[model samples]
Target: MTHIVDAAWQKILTTYGEPVPPDASPLLEPFAVLARVAHAEPLLRRLHPWTGMWELHFSRCTEMNYTWDLPYIGTLRDGRYYVEGPDRSSPRIAETDSAQAAVAMVVDRLPPGCGPAFLGNAGELAAYEKTRDQG
Candidate 1:
């Protein structure tokens, strides 16, 4: 039987057009927690281009724009999980012994009034923003 979290992740993968890399297996539990909390939102799992660590991105939209408000979660060399805020130059938002705890931190820190993500590219998101603004 397929688990609900697995099913949800499958949907994200289908929409995201890329399979989770094998090295990301370590992050599955935390990813599942995030997937459960943001079930209605679209999610992206990718390897950070420079660091090559797996990261989970959360997107939210406004009347005129969309941004990944939640920090990405990744593992440190020492095995702790960390949440990095949008401003990479700043200190990490959180670090925890468990990836699930780190993900919980992310959920707790979601921006005020944040809703389900706009499921599209930047242009499509802009179009959506335009329509919403016009209404």
Candidate 2:
């Protein structure tokens, strides 16, 4: 069965166009690994519209579904993968020359109890969270 996160990512690909595959550019291998390994989480992946860098973020309940302001992964000019903190001005959380290492760092930092994305609007997600919390 297709996971909810995989379906969400398919929608993102159809909407924003596909990112170049890892085979096409070695720098993107970590992104590919992240997508594969984190297939069950509430994560969304995309390419930055302006920078064309691979980006990852938690799935949100907004119209876009992606929490764009969250921490994301990008490749440095020197061919290392780095996870930037929440905003552009925020410092890098981790940087590594190995794709596995970078992917691990991103996985380790996922938000607590993120689970599968709600796949709904903010109001619905809020309701779900409230119910989940109360149970």
| Candidate with maximal lDDT | 2
Worst 10 residues of 2 by lDDT: 42-51
What is the lDDT for 55 in model 1? 57
TM-score of each: 0.52, 0.56
Per residue, candidate 1 scores C-alpha lDDT tens digits across 38-110 of 3433232211111224555554532223354456666655556778876456578877777557656766776
- Per-residue CA lDDT of model 2 for 19-70, tens digit only, reads 7754566545455555454433433332221123566555444334334445
lDDT of 1 at 81: 70
**RMSD vs true structure, all candidates:** 7.9, 5.9
The most accurate candidate by TM-score is 2
Candidate 2: regions farther than 4 A off: 1-4, 10-52, 60-65, 68-70, 122-124, 130-135
Clashing pairs in 1: none
